[model samples]
Target chain A: MADEVILLDFPLSAFGMRVRIALAEKGVKYEYREEADFMKRIKSDLLLKMNPVHKKIPVLIHNGKPVCESLIIVQYIDEVWKDKSPWLPSDPYQRAQARFWTDFADKKIYGDSRSVWSTKGEEREAFLENFKVLEAELGDKPFFVSDTFGFADIALVTFYGWFYSIKTFGQFSIEAECPTIVAWAKRCMQRESIARTLPD
Target chain B: MADEVILLDFPLSAFGMRVRIALAEKGVKYEYREEADFMKRIKSDLLLKMNPVHKKIPVLIHNGKPVCESLIIVQYIDEVWKDKSPWLPSDPYQRAQARFWTDFADKKIYGDSRSVWSTKGEEREAFLENFKVLEAELGDKPFFVSDTFGFADIALVTFYGWFYSIKTFGQFSIEAECPTIVAWAKRCMQRESIARTLPD
Candidate 1:
């Protein structure tokens, strides 16, 4: 049986972009269903049915089963299509560390810019400390978990789309605040998968 | 070299209980370091150095390295000790579903009672809807994700210790509000690992 993969998402969603990048990384072809009224705070019935609990977008329907939450969806993609470049590390300890950083970004840094922009409408302040911490973690490494641009990279780099809006509203450049992070993200972008999916 | 395992935790932490339960389930022997001043929000130098990023308790030190965050720590435990009773399910799709529910409890349900109790002093309300959703998901199954008491059960059952306090502050019994959830918790407690680790 052919695999039926459908992604219910609107464009310009940082979370959705994570899935796209992951799918692109895996070279997994999926049906894309854009939620037309998502920006207006109206959910498509398919989205509501797919993610009844969160009622959020970026639901990855693989063979009719829905995987909600952006990071979870990415992990699902990684696990399902393991024949390609791996997102998670092979070592147990390294995998835990990879998950830790990804989870950290999801909890702390990911939503702040979006919420600040959408709610206050140009009133903003950058949480530069989080970025600085990220920079320190990256150090001289080519990627977050070393040479490979893997799980943590996918999680944080997707937010690069909103960095422009963040700089515009907050009046602070991510390049200036965390040069190392920007460098890492730019390195990630050089990959056609991330470069293609990440919004301008 | 023999494995040197150590757990840095203060008893009475729901998150700490989760680590303890996971360790017990795997029958892995480890040194338990009690953080006496955790209730005062004071960190020992060990906990500080071990989990420099979060500076939170419940750091699982396997060998010489540290793994922080409860769910991350639990996953670490699950991965490192794959010989025993598995916390996560085997199939990729089932694993995603397990992670989804656990993530829901972590984000929505886990910290509410603690913050509410600590700050407002008995001014509280049970987010019974979340519990009802959980109960509906449980259905007639002996455990979440069918038969085997695993990931989601570990995540939620740790909170059973706080159910009494939630009832007192919110003035609603979980037994009444969500009997199936309570019953499931009780059933999980019958397991020696959970029964031993969970605090009253």
Candidate 2:
């Protein structure tokens, strides 16, 4: 039986973009339905029914079962489409490390990115320092986990959109401070999966 | 050769308690190191080295490598210890569902628990409403996912400690509002893994 996959999405959401990149990387054919009125607080009934708990996109409806949460959706996409290179690492510890960083991106980086552009002085500096922490994690690796381009890369690279915003908004350079991070992001953007998400 | 396992923990922490329950469920014997001075902002050097990212516990150091984050650590414990019954669901969809709720607990419920105790009026009512959301998820099921006691249960039941605190502080009953949730907690509390976490 052919698999039916539907992604309830909003184009500008980094979380939705994570799923989009993962699906694109794995070469999964899915119906991408943009929640056109998402910003206006109008959710489709299908979305509400599919993801009653959160009532948010990007909900991945596979064969009628809904997977909410962007990281979980990326993972579901990785697990179901086993023909491609896995998005997450293979080893348990490495996998844990990958998840830890992704969770960090979700918890810490996501929150900081929202206000960094609007804030001033010490607040913005603290936010920039958080990026340096990520740069330190990236280190000499071409990717966050060793040289492999997978989960951690997908999770962090989606924020390139927000990075551009922060830089443009403040007339500052993230690349000026965290060269390695910018370089690593550029490396990830070279991939077809990532490039399509932020095609601007 | 024996498996060298150690858990960096704090007795009062819901996050640390999640790991302790999983380890206890798997019956994996290891050194349990309490972060006695954690509340004092004094961290052990081992913890500092093990989880340099967060500098937090409970870090499960197995064979000298660290796994941080409670949900990730619980998943790691399930993956590493082959002899035990699995903590997470095997099916990809169910696994995604389990991960979703656990993430919800970490992000939402964890925050709500902290202030619910000290809150009044509408804030306290809204906090109780969150448990009602959880109760709706549980429904008639013995556990969060199903009849099995595993990851989702471990993630939430640790908050039973805070449940008591909120009840005591607010001079109200959570069970009165969320009986199914309270019943499920009682069911989980009967297990040795959970019983030991909140022996008081």
Candidate 3:
């Protein structure tokens, strides 16, 4: 397509996968540039130039300008292509609740959950505390929302893929601690977009 | 102003200050309910019914429905009443950049900066690393954005206020390490809304 969006991302990156799923959901065609890892020092020159701070993948280049941050990119996509699947709820209160969950998933679940990859000690313990908070906050709710696949679902799904792929910290067993969240994650993955985009 | 919006918050909260400055910028009339710390702890009958999880302050109950999360509340305010001082920029790319900086200030600056409050060690070192990233990202730019005061400025001003107020990390002064950021903080403080909302 002449006007297809250009997504600069790696297939395995959960952050990049989120954008791919969003695009697929909206049925938007795009060019996908797989970026090499910086650990190997083989990433695209454009990516290096674009994201100097994080130098991370999942930089969505829509109409030539790059947008980083997976959640931010998702929101920008939703705003630009309004009313297709309606990622954000219409009611302001519901929308705020959605945003709170999205922020919670990003900052608390995905943000603090990364400590499993840390070297260990206080940092890992703090991350566990953070993860505990998410589990506590999630009581028995089927999803963060009353009934829907929305922004929060999108974010958590990304984290879920990470949890399974990493296979460390005994987190591969999401069933015992957070059954509801596990079920929710499964439900989100059942979608074709999610099923296709999830990393191996 | 019978139909005016209502803001439920406290000055001590950097989140609440975000809403306050946004309201003042828009010149919107509203009632400000100073939520008490005990009220937050005990979860007042009203707030408990309004915001269940993460029962923190900075809830803007506009036309009765509560919108929690300071940034979300600001966006809702901007969307609902857009005839006044625009919180978001016009161009899509510029707007995305503005949102990026706003989120960046929250995550990297405000969120990471809080580590400094803890006793010096790995956490403090991590905090300093985050600050260095901010310094590197923001070389000589007076504002996070190019020139104009936008979403990022509002977010940073809140952080500067809290960092200045907190005695826990009084030894680590921004004036000494981050002169540019300190100067920017001072420039932002000169704004009427910011100066007026000082915690007594």
Candidate 4:
């Protein structure tokens, strides 16, 4: 039986972009439905029915069932389509490490980005300090998990698409602070999967 | 060769209790190091060294390595000790569902509990409204994922220990709001693994 996959998403959401990159990586075909009225507080009934719990986007509906949460959907994609490219490491500890950093990106990076754009003075400085911590973690590694464009890479590189807007709103230069991370992100962008899915 | 496992945790923490319960469920023996001075703003060197990223509790140190984050640790325990008992379902979709609710518990439940305890009037009312959403999800299911007391159950039921304090602080009866959820929590409490690990 042929698989039917549909993604309920918004174009600007980094979370939604993560799923797109993952699907593209494994060469999976999926219908992408952009939630145009998402910002206006109007959500489609299809989205609401598919994700009753959160009523949010990036819901992957596969054969009528829905998977909510971006990271969970990415993991589901990796598990169901393990043939071509593996998003996570095979070893248990390595897998745990991958999850930990991906989770870090989810919890910390996005929040820090928001704060960087919305706050000022000492508050924005504090958020910049947090951003530096992420920079230090990236350090010399080509990718977050060291030499593999896997889960953490997918989790974080989506933010590269939004760096312009974040820097504009915050009045800061990401390249000035974290050149290595920028270089790494540029490398990830070279991939057809990431290049195609990420918004300009 | 014997396996050496250690859990660095705090007794009062519901997150820490989660790791304890999973370890007990798997019948794995491990050293439990209570972080008595955690509230005093004093973190042990081992805790910092093991989890440099978060520098938080519920770190499962297996052999010499550490796995941070409660859900991640619980998943790790399940993966490593697959022979004894499984914390997560084997099916891909079911596992995704379990993870979604578990993530909900992690993101929503703790913050809602804090608001329930620390606020009053409309602020508290707003949190109570959020709490009801969780109650609604529980519905008639024996567990978050049907009949099985799996990942989502473990993620949530640990907070049952704090319900007394929350109810007292908020001046409300959880039983009145959601009897089914309370009943399910009671069912989980009957397990020796949960009974022994959860605090009063």
Best by DockQ: 2
C-alpha lDDT of all candidate models, in order: 0.83, 0.83, 0.73, 0.84
Q: Which scores greater on TM-score, model 2 or model 4?
A: 2
Each candidate: chain B TM-score: 0.91, 0.93, 0.86, 0.93
The better-scoring model by lDDT among 2 and 3 is 2
List per-candidate RMSD values in Å: 3.0, 1.8, 5.2, 2.0
Task: Give the CAPRI rating of model 1.
Answer: high
Q: In model 3, state the lDDT of residue B47.
A: 63
In DockQ, how does model 2 score against the reference complex?
0.84
| Fnat by candidate, in order | 0.85, 0.88, 0.56, 0.82
- Model 4 root mean square deviation, Cα atoms: 2.0
Docking class of 4: medium
Tens-place lDDT digits, model 3, residues A1-200? 36558888876677787888888888878888877664566788888777776677888887777888888888888777775877877765677677787887776666666676677667666655655656765677766665667787776678777666445654434555566667767888788999888865
Docking outcome class, model 2:
high
In model 2, what are the clashing residue pairs, if there are any?
none
Q: In angstroms, how far off is B118's CA in candidate 3?
A: 7.1
Q: Runs in model 2 with CA error above 4 Å?
A: A36-39, B36-39
DockQ (Cα-based) per candidate? 0.82, 0.84, 0.42, 0.76
Candidate 1 residues A55-108, lDDT tens each?
988899998889999999998898888888687888999999899899879876
lDDT of 3 at A62: 77
- In every candidate, how many clashes are there? 0, 0, 0, 0
DockQ of 1: 0.82
Q: Name the 10 consecutive residues with the lowest summed lDDT in model 3 chain A.
A: A165-174
